[model samples]
Target: MTRIDSLRAGDPPRIGGYELAGRIGEGGQGSVFLATAPSGDQVAIKLLGSALTGGDDDPGPGFARESEILRRVAPFCTAQVIESGLLEDRPYIVSEYIDGPTLQQVVEGEGPLEGARLRRLAVGTLTALTAIHRAGVVHRDFKPSNVLLGRDGPRVIDFGIARALDAVATGSGVVGTPPYMAPEQLEGAQVEPPADLFAWGSTMVFAATGRPPFGMDSLPAIVNRILHRDPDLGLLRGDLRDLVAECLSKDAARRPTAGEALMRLLGARDRPVGFLLSAGSAAASGSPAPPHIPDSGDAPALSPGASRPPPGAGARSRARRRAAILGAGVTVALASGALVHALTRDGAPARPEATGPARPLPEVTSVPPPATTELRLPGLGTTLHENPGDTARMVSFMYDSKGGSNHYARVRGTNRFEAVAPWQEPLPSPDGTWLALLPWLKESTPQPYDFVRLVHVPSGREYIVRLTDKPLQNFNPAWSPDGTRLLLTTFDLSSGSRTPVGFAIVDAAAAKATLVRADTSGAPAAAPFAWSPGEPAVALPFGAGPRAGLRFFDLNGRTLRTADGVGEAAASESPFAPAGKRFATGCPGAFASVCVWDTATGRALARFRVPAQSAFIGWYNDAHVLLTDKSADPHKVVVMDMKGEVLRVLAEIPREEPGENRGTFLFHYMRWS
Candidate 1:
């Protein structure tokens, strides 16, 4: 259930009333020993390691002061202290050993908690703070790593005794993790409950987004941001968003009291979980529940060859003592380039250019697939019948006037479609072997917390690839010709404006991704781009920003070519022709006009005018182009030939009510079977 470390040589077998078993946890200040109490119950005894003992065999005045206060804290959503004593002038405190992972472990591995789990995490920790403050004890170092996600609820650890470390906050010495420290604490001023509340808000941000609200940085830089900058909490919403921002107020006196913050959370607990939640309520029961109860902490550390500690392992000081803490639990198998070419079009496809070096990106890995009974995904909206013999598949968040939205899947056929799982923005691979689910599909956290979830079609296995760590948004994911890589464009936020920056190429199996044609020196280019399917080049739009359209970039961040006279290619449209030689996109103005470009010559070949208020989807074939009209009763797909002739129309996808904002939501991104 949690990552446990084994005993090592030179470890003392016994300390007073406890028999030391193994090393369970190691922090900057002390080593937690998993030991047996006098009555045989398991307990964690934290003894000051040699680093803090100072080779004098005695912990100074700090230890005695810590021991006196810890004894007063009773058990109530916190680890209950059993006893504290000195052995050979060395100090140790024994408490009930909680068997769960740290809050950091849960968010880092799971990627920003949601649903009842996130609620339980919030309410439980606040309850702990209420109880701790009620007892007149302040947990100065409240952070993600210090909160243990127990099975029953969240338990705040490292509460009363952390003061023994006596680490300062001003100048060079930081008493706690800088990102979680309040402005007053960072200023080395006298701190109280408000300081801890400030840390609580920062912890909530990390629990909700897998990163600190202020972003990671050096100690000096973090202190500067803490004083001048507000947290980048664009991913959070509703009550949690407002509360976190309030607690993080730069003015110490402006921060809410712990009890006041608790009442605010309890108020939110009484209402609907808001638009950010998966459903109107958190769990199926629909009754208000404790917010932090569902945060289940999994195993600890990395298996082998992990060059770095996972998530919250880095707390307090910059230096960490590395040991064999993380054991093997789950692993991802790399199976790249096993895809069979699915479809081929007859055309004079241009020769793809020789690629340069590749950027080393982190690989996406799979977890053990969740086991469940056969799922029935019903009501997948209007199905478009494809070639009877074709095997291509499509996935959508089925929206019915009566039923609302549900995850549904169907191949391009009249065959009965079924629901596989509840996920959003599903894009099947060109080969139909895998389905890529966008992270923002089911959850409501902003783009920064989004992930690219890939599911195996046959086994229903799912893997996640974190697209970007920065507070950014992305859309329009297109699979490569081989189905091994995925292309998506990144958007940056500056002064409250979100603009497209550059296109990212993701290796699904490897879980690594890199951006192309992005401005490395200045702000990233804010424009959409589409891959040429089989080639190394991509077609991007031209806009008021750098790296805008009429430009082609290779897989590696290099600009290949640029064309003229093509309208600003929107991210919603791809330019590559079915044969992969020409580019097509909607015009820049209010009129519905389609512009096609020759990829080889960077020249406009033809321009066709269509009915107003229509979008250019893509080319069905070399001669036939596909378009969609929103004004129709049912959304109609219009097919036009290269000669500007109206060829035919396909089925319409029912439109939702006007004014409903589905961020970057489109009809579908269909890949060949």
Candidate 2:
């Protein structure tokens, strides 16, 4: 064991063949020291605290666990663990010294980040978590202080208390900071990956507002607020509000998984609309464009009216026109100059079109005929597919203009849409009343890191379903026809390349998930995997390559069967139809064609050729599928039946501005009881 007295400042002790310079920081468990290697490179060495070292019993097991966890995660998502050993009655671990300040220090020094910068921080941190969770460990303590804002990107550190799947039984204690702990952890319940998500969410709040969601005060008060109160997200913008809200959920199961959180952040940053101008144009000395204008075709143009009278009918009219032109030009010139100045001051490249006039709105397309139309819910901003019983409704995952995580919802009657709580993955339930959400986890932790959450729409209740102990990324959740079981896909990166890890079934009501089968073959490109509604099996199209084919797997991670003759084809993005009698898959071209498959016999049923340059496919009833083609001069939404017959042309929703590409419109699924 290493002696504590020898770790004092100015004591030149050789460790790992490096001379320790001085103590940098001391904590409850260890003291960090600035050291120089044989090559003179700087590194930080942590020695166990004297409290634990002074005990008669050996405290090497804890250090051994930390070293093993670090070694397991180093290949995937952490700073390299240089060396670890024992010396003079104390054990020590040495790691490369990260130069950047901790996230806590950065936030304290710079206040809070806003706009694009905040979003970037959230994305970067979540990406780190994604890498960490893929390695099958749960980071027991994740907070701003443990994250390093390095020049390359964010790096997750301090995995001294991380727990692996096979080791969680031996790891249970109040190990993390109370304010950042998940509700379950605060309540003394067994913690899981979602606990890390809670910490991440609180950490983000600190990064954005320079204050934790639970407020900084006594530990008891902070823990109390974290357990019961909701986070105030008024200060966040873009997708951050939703992302942080999901993270700070009192119910740990409601938070999004790291992978899903990363995707939501990406979607918010890559929104369809351009950057919005600030509200006051005069204050900034610029002409702000109108937010939106209604389209009015064939309306009589209004005449230009002015107060000053002209000198003559000929000369006066000429002079008035000249004055009008000059006035418009001057406005444009001033605005352009201001914009250029602002860009230059911010060190941003100036746009050539900054001086141009705002473009006119595009002509509105003719409204499509209402075919079996149901109630319209514009307040929801997206349409919903009502269930056959009218007891539940289904809507697609959509985002609010302010940065918020996208989630699906189910509504009944005229009631407000209640968000599905637990499943952060954003996959809908078969009955369309609940959704599966993957709560976010910390990076720099080991795996099997899977957690599933279920949301009850009408009541807004969240259910936490513990799935596995191994740190694996789970997604694309689908409910079986009987509604007794839920099917999902897992992606494992433990062996290097991302492989088709496996599929599993969870008893939805009991909150028990069991692995059915796992693919031991080489890594496959991640795609949507669906369970046939009528059969007790699932189909995963391995894409076009050597391992390309529609492979079938039972619930136990075993490939029960395989089919040879589907040619080499890629899978589709949309979900499969009910009963799995017929499903749609994407095809290469300007538009994605539909390839129908017979689930019973595992054969091709029929091929529906879509309109050229189409993008998305939606089911209108069971017989007709809706296709939207935005690539043409006048975009169109065509309804095609299974016989390859074009039944009708729906009213086109016109593009907001000319030359703008709307791509495909999403028609949400709803059912009426």
Candidate 3:
């Protein structure tokens, strides 16, 4: 590992819960310091530059983009972000530190890569891109230097922030290196995921040949070569050569998606798709696991001394040496996508070939079940099932804006109010940085559904997603415990209340949504359900009134066959814990009683009649049940230790009206910070 230096003259000793060890790396946007977490884990804390963070009250896009993206694509092929908070008014983010050398250092020092080694690098990086895309994000600055070849494998870093910065106009200083830039980028055009593919091709070419696709040259010359010339592959052959060429296709539409690229790189038509793979971690008990890590031979590792030249040597120097090495030449007309053409230096034709024949890469529409689950949760009963630290630590609420046009939310007990329409409810993410707003399109109108608009509260940035190709409506957006995915119920708005539609799992970043088949009974519609806080199964309402029972579905929305009695009981109004093995709900027509059910069997394990006119709030933990005694003076909530003995009264609230309940969190995931 590279040695960690001591704090410099300007460095702060501590930030939030992390203590600085020393500066490990620095980039154009910020400085990265090796730090120690309160729990003693090693972390890399990045202090963002002032230009990106914005003024004290208003931060720019890149300031929060990386954290938001990392939060959504964690535990995959990335250095997961742990927490983010300001230090002395400047923003800082701490992420799990990956000890490894960049792809640049490895290839540069070890010479050109080939065979299994090259295959591994390609597969690993491609898989990383796939995961990022799956989460609704695009890595605009995807180059060798941004990839860390760790002990476990390659991890993609600096994703969203780069994209946001790269979007800034070129004359003001573009974010990415010119040699690795797509032609469209150089032409000052709009960039997207397709741009990443072009950069990926350049990266692969550099890795395999120890030179950029375009030979190293002056900036003007490199720009000309990129726009007008075809990369000189020079002896590069086989499937690798073909794939790289396709990735560098002048036409963006002709390029394959990250997923498709991965599938083709592994030869989908040849293997079982995952014909060769690395053993990846299993999914959270009973949930769908992520894609496999491609199995490949051991590649050369980056030694501590393998660190590249410092900033004093300049980023352009390393970028030039590792990116474009083409001779000087210059122009071409602007076009769609990130590619261009040119008239040669001596006014010759650009090149005879068109980025190969426009062959399409195989598309992987969905990720197939790779392996059987090895971890099973004991569905003993429901208690507090989710990580409630963040929610439990603060009381989130909404208030009238004194007859103003919109309502406001007191986020995280910060006393800082954010204006949200009365039609919206502020459900903060587990990290407390984002708030998911479920707004009724027409609150005064009697509509059957609503859509969610995710807002980064601190930055005021929002991601409004359509979730469909047509003008469809969605409702009841539920945030998963990790806040990476959202569970939504789709409604055929035209169908009215007489029918039921289905459910969908949305990638919070990319806005890509998949419809899940939750209604096996073929009903026209169904009520929205709450995910069991942690796993894939959700407790959904199948029918109406007392006749309605709860059905469980996996993340893909496939019905899971449980004990026959399980679906026979009515779903309670209280929220299910994230990983609860048991659940507690009050009997519908009761003399006021609380009941705990075996989530897997639909069998009641315990029942306790509470004081008159009371309702079950939720389970405090696996051993305790929380219920409200409305019959008591006003309404008092009490926690019972499962043995019918009252342990403690948690809180007291005003009596709720017959059809109105002031609390819904009793049914949602909550965590104490």
User: Which is the leading candidate under TM-score?
Assistant: 2
Highest lDDT among the candidates is held by which one? 1
Q: How close is every model to the real structure, measured as TM-score?
A: 0.45, 0.51, 0.40
Model 1 Cα shift for residue 196 (angstroms): 20
State the lDDT of candidate 2 residue by residue for 453-543, as single tens digits.
5543323334545443333445445555544466666544333223455665666555556654455453244454566445566666654
List model 1 lDDT by residue over 1-673, tens digit each: 6666778897788998799888887877778988998898999888876555555544546577666677676455678778877666567888888888899888888788764467657767887787778778888899998889775567888886656555311123546788999998888787788989899999988887888888786877888889998787857776678888999999878988876676455431222212111222121122221212111122211213322211321111111110111111111110111111111011112222222222211221121122222222344334353343221122343331112234444543333454433324556666555566664221122112235656544443445555543334455567766776787766543222335666666666665555443532322233455665456766665643223356666656566666644555522436676556666654434234555666676565666665554555555555555655544555555556654555555434544444322112233434343
Each candidate: what lDDT? Answer: 0.56, 0.49, 0.51
Comparing 2 with 3 on TM-score, the higher-scoring candidate is 2
Q: By summed lDDT, which 10 consecutive residues of candidate 2 come out lowest? A: 333-342
| lDDT tens digits, residue span 329-410, model 3 | 2111100000111111121112221121121112211211122222111111112121222112212333211111132343
Q: How many residue pairs collide in each prediction?
A: 20, 60, 41
Q: Ten consecutive residues with minimal summed lDDT in candidate 3?
A: 333-342
Q: Rank the candidates by TM-score, best first.
A: 2, 1, 3
lDDT of 1 at 15: 91
Per-residue lDDT, model 1, residue 526, is 38
